[model samples]
Target: MPAALRITLTTQEHQTLKELEVAECVPRRTKQRATALRLNAKGGKVKAIADYLGWAQSTVRQTIHRWNHHGLAGLWEAKGRGRKPSWTSQDWEALEQWLQEPRSISSRQLSQRWAKQRQVFVGAEQVRRILKKKWRWKRFRKKPPVPKNPELKAAKKRDLQTLKLWAQEDLITLLYLDESGCCSESPLYYGYSPIGQQKSISQRSRKGRRVNIMGVWEQDNRFEYTLKVGTYNANSYLRFMEWQAQKAMKRLFETGKPTVIIHSGRFNPSCQGS
Candidate 1:
């Protein structure tokens, strides 16, 4: 038989190991206890303990040496050994403060400010991640500008009130009319797609087709007006309005004094009294 490697531990060290085993505060304490027992009581060498436990010989020796020197505290691993944080708490606080500012800022602008103010260089993607994840921010695109005309708004409101009053008195008349432009060349609707299926090529075509649609709608049914002109201008729209009014009058003459409501485009003067 090969000679056995002798292992030794002082009485004080053995007593401390016993206390640590009893405490069992840290993770892997049982393993540490078994190692200590094999070393102190069973006279198992470092190599033997390592072989039995399937750990490195240096690991076994270090565990025993740590318990001998620093007692229980040495067995616990040090903080921040696995992976370092991308940004510190202070950096996060600074970023939040910057985001809370009233002025609208782009990602690139924020990145530049971060470098100057925090003295830390970070990419736009990192800044975006911090903003979205940490701050729960969302991106918004501004809406298209609407034509502002206070006079027109006031006139429309007045017209609506007048129509409502006529309606209550049983003198109200309503006609629904609208014109829509249709095109064969559809507008591109941009949106996100999964990574692998993303399209890389674009389609190009110079000549496309288009058609215009015009119609009138009422509570009961719809009256589709002729395409009239290729493009419906204010003149063509006025003509459509005349046609709808004449049709309504003829129906009212035959059906008696029934109330009529006219819904027409802004450019149509059909609502105006003759």
Candidate 2:
């Protein structure tokens, strides 16, 4: 009959294995192997060590053989035992710092930065996983800063809903007007030019004059007006609104429907708006 496996350890080897238990830097497999070796060195049977450590007998034997051959280095797992990590904990720490910085960065851009800084090629998906799983980072879209008036925004939404309901009831026609203004610094458009012919730079220059224009956005038709006011004021805006309301009422009167003019301060005679 084959004799039972007998493993023994020296004093230095025993101390090193004990230290591995408290060592946080050692890998999990290394710690487990160290514990197994420690148990075996104290006259513990191979089967007992394996059962105590919840490891296979073959694993315990392999660890013993490795320790007998390589000593301290044997405590570590062999190379290529598992998948290689493209990034280390230090890389993840740097990534977390970057994420904490108040700036917008996309996953693709972050991967590029990682590749450049770490001098290692990493895929966006892999980086994304590292950020999500390792760092628990969340994805969010950046939006332009608007009013913080959520209540006002909610009110506007309710008003829009009411308008939609009114439209369904034929209460009033919805003429969504999109007003705009162009100044000498703003490009309204290029003047009329022959087809396939480019106009001169002087003619296309927006510095020539300033103009304000508005278009009624409704149905398949639109009424656009161009006005030139050096500085738009309340009077110019009121005139524009009055003109639009006149046109709207004219159409409503033809249809025998009451005219309800819903106007707010939205006209700019001068370079303010169009």
Candidate 3:
């Protein structure tokens, strides 16, 4: 079937293996590996070496190959080679069940629970690694809030997909509208100016009033924004909507394309001046 594995050892190599095979404090596994190599060097057959050492023929062949490739280093166990994982299939099944509980569990808490039930001490880091590498679990910043109406939410999501398709096909332009305010006292912390000049911000008053900004952004990067001296009110918002309507009508008249505007549905009391 295949050629028999063989090895030839130098005088110095044989002496070193012999000493390692009989060293009082050497681990038994290392001694076995050393003896297997020594026997192969002395013309012992794989099957005969395995029978003598009570190891499998495959193990003996592996020993000969390893010694040929790695010399003496292969006589010791390789890094990350040792006992099989203590967590069995049943243990993983139990872990899966634990994860399905309504209440969430932290990795450290789960490790403690695992130690109590299985009588084995696995650290939180190890538990996290297994969850990520083996189970493909991910870390999320926070859980999303449960919607009050899930069916409506699903319908809205489907509608959004349809809208995106329409926008991609140029059937309609999609725009997003948002509003926020900032105070002059909190100027941008950083800005670029000439090499010798420090950028300066000038305010009309020592304590400047808030500047309200309303902006509408099109999916294709076109946008319009307005800055108001005071907070936005219902009348101001209505005026902005009217301006957008006029712009959309002009675009439709010229390009024959319709437009759809989307905004966060949350109502702001300030928007109504209430």
Candidate 4:
């Protein structure tokens, strides 16, 4: 068994609690908490206080402890305390904007971004809980845009069917190619830059120096890449394809398996220039 806790109160504190216990205007829960604390202060045991107030023993002990720790303010409910709100209206608005499509940033990324933006620390789980409970945000697959021309749409469906046949026959291995680049003055930077802090990535501005990367990936854990400076062009794309082909062939030859490389990417009249 543990020693019984004895709460000692000052003359003013005892009197204040006594008044609150019977005050009609005070909320019922507040009165109960006040009475519980008062009984404890008068040298009542935890069980005695709980029985007298019709509250749990744990509740009685917690009430007295809160009163001691926070004085009068602790006796009353504090705004935004306990359990916590999902998020403020402002936070919800910011979240909506952050989750706008084509930017496939995950919940973890948004949580980290918000912490940096707000200068307050929070976890990814917290972000997920709010999104799920409040907004009911769920994963939705992004589908490719349908072509307005019926002929083009049907042609794509036919090509897809042919590719499915090839896949079933093991005649081709589908590999996806993607490329991207970044440069300063991109104007997409978001942050909570503190005052008097240097923000530039480099000591001096290198605004026009562009970086280019091309990657090839497929199922079965096969992948390769080409990275260089300058713009993505027809020559650059062809060279990347050739490099990936040689690597893929050498690997497959060692394994005594042969596969035809089938590249996947959109061909647009507009990208007649990427």
Top model by lDDT, which number?
Answer: 3
Q: How many clashes does each candidate structure show, in the order listed? A: 8, 3, 1, 0
Model 3 C-alpha lDDT versus the unseen true structure = 0.74
Best by TM-score, which number?
A: 3
Q: Give candidate 3 regions above 4 Å deviation.
A: 1-148, 183-209, 266-274
Better of 2 and 4 by TM-score: 2
C-alpha lDDT score of every prediction, in listed order:
0.58, 0.65, 0.74, 0.64
Arranged by TM-score with the best first, the candidates are 3, 2, 1, 4
Reference-based TM-score of each model? 0.34, 0.35, 0.36, 0.32
Error of 3 at 70 (Å): 53
After TM-score superposition, the amount by which residue 76's alpha carbon in candidate 2 deviates from its true location, in angstroms, is 1.5
* Candidate 4 lDDT tens digits, 19-44: 99887556567888877777776778
The candidate with the higher TM-score, 2 or 3, is 3
- Candidate 3, 169-263: lDDT as tens digits: 98998988888777866443332222333433332222456888888998657889888987677888889889999999999999899989878
Full ranking by lDDT: 3, 2, 4, 1
* Model 1 lDDT on a 0 to 1 scale: 0.58
Model 2 residue 217 lDDT?
53
lDDT agreement of model 2 with the native: 0.65
Candidate 1 vs candidate 4: which has greater lDDT? 4
